[model samples]
Target: MKRLLRAVPIAAAASLAMPAHAQFAKPEDAYKYRASVMFLQSQHMGRINGQLKSDKPDLALVAENAAILDVVNKLSFTAFPEGSDMLANSRAKPEVWSQAAKFKQYADRLNVDVGRLLAASKGGDLAATREAFQATAKVCKACHDDFRRD
Candidate 1:
């Protein structure tokens, strides 16, 4: 039972990454995959922001949204495979591929930032959570400014 409980979390984490491992059939598919994942991320962030703006900020809800953000965040970066920027629906700039290392740096930083946000929310510290949220948003904005087309 103890071993099974431990494996459950491991299995769950692996499943979340399953899509990232799959080869997208085409550039459009890759764009769609990343776009969908990013959409989910945006929606979750909006939900957390809404909770934060409420008179009675619900740290629990924030944490829930943060958790979802944490997972979707990891997934989106993986979908930005080569040549996906050519897709009509893609807003990704050439910099995403041209300045690959810098783009990856942003992706890695965003993951860490979101992790911090999750920790702050789970700790039930509203101020800390707000600070962490802002930090995460800054990373997102910086990445968008550099890699995404307007």
Candidate 2:
């Protein structure tokens, strides 16, 4: 009886801690989340770019930004469920779902490029960081061109 009571409260607390629509009750929610994450990724990328352009670039900030980009890059792909592409406000192209394998390949390339960027940033080599950033940008543009709408 004591164990059951303890488990009940723990279970309830765990359930309550989850987001209201943790499973995405509507496709719009997934689309919104995806948009938000992309915005965050862009912000981090912008920060890195700005730092690189500065007369005295801050390698620490660049590394921090790259780390953030690495994490966000991992998260972006999960937001695109089957129905998420159908959301009225979503800028995701239908090809993202129709050509899922290709989309995933692009996403994987992004992961690799971001990892390289993170590694270069950590090494504190400005030239290498610039090269890695260019590689990452190319992956982003390729994915966006194939999977996103204007």
Candidate 3:
């Protein structure tokens, strides 16, 4: 019957909409989240690079003045699910989800470094800000080198 047909499609869609994310039901979501965080972090860093590369004091001041901690501040405490199949084409190493503890440690270090950078920036100290920024990059790179596929 027509009623039965309608009910069947609705039921099928309902099943697909189920939100049973296995601690990590889709692996690619991890990659997506990582990409999101890194992209946001780099935006400001890119500005800093341009300012330093030009060696313009006024440029440096303008870059620092326009800077804010909010970008990195909003990125903490996020965790990716462990084994979602959505990660099929991702460059993230399975070890990242497999070794959650180490992954978390690296994330925490980034949070700390960003926090320090935020404070240093507020003081208008460009040198300290650059050091903290590099430290944050190191934390991210160190982990990626070991666990990322590419």
TM-score of each: 0.85, 0.83, 0.64
Tens-digit lDDT track for model 2 on 92-147? Answer: 99898678768878878888888888888898888999999998889989999988
Which of the two, 2 or 3, has more lDDT? 2
Candidate that beats the other on TM-score, 1 or 2, i.e. the better one:
1
TM-score of 2: 0.83
Of the pair 2 and 3, which is ahead by TM-score? 2
Task: Estimate every model's Cα lDDT from 0 to 1.
Answer: 0.79, 0.76, 0.55
Writing each residue's lDDT as its tens digit, candidate 1 over 72-149 gives 888887676666677677889988767876877887788888999999999999999999999888998999998888
Residue-pair clashes per candidate: 0, 0, 5
On lDDT, the candidate that comes out on top is: 1
Q: Is candidate 1 or candidate 3 better by TM-score?
A: 1
* Deviation in Å, model 1, residue 103 alpha carbon: 0.5
**lDDT tens string, model 3, 1-150?**
223222323332232233332222234544566566567667766665566556553434533533543344234223244343144566667686567668667766766787776666666677777787788668868987977767
Worst 10 residues of 3 by lDDT: 16-25
Report the error of model 1 at residue 139, Å: 1.1
- Evaluate model 3: give its TM-score: 0.64
Off by over 4 Å in 2: 1-22
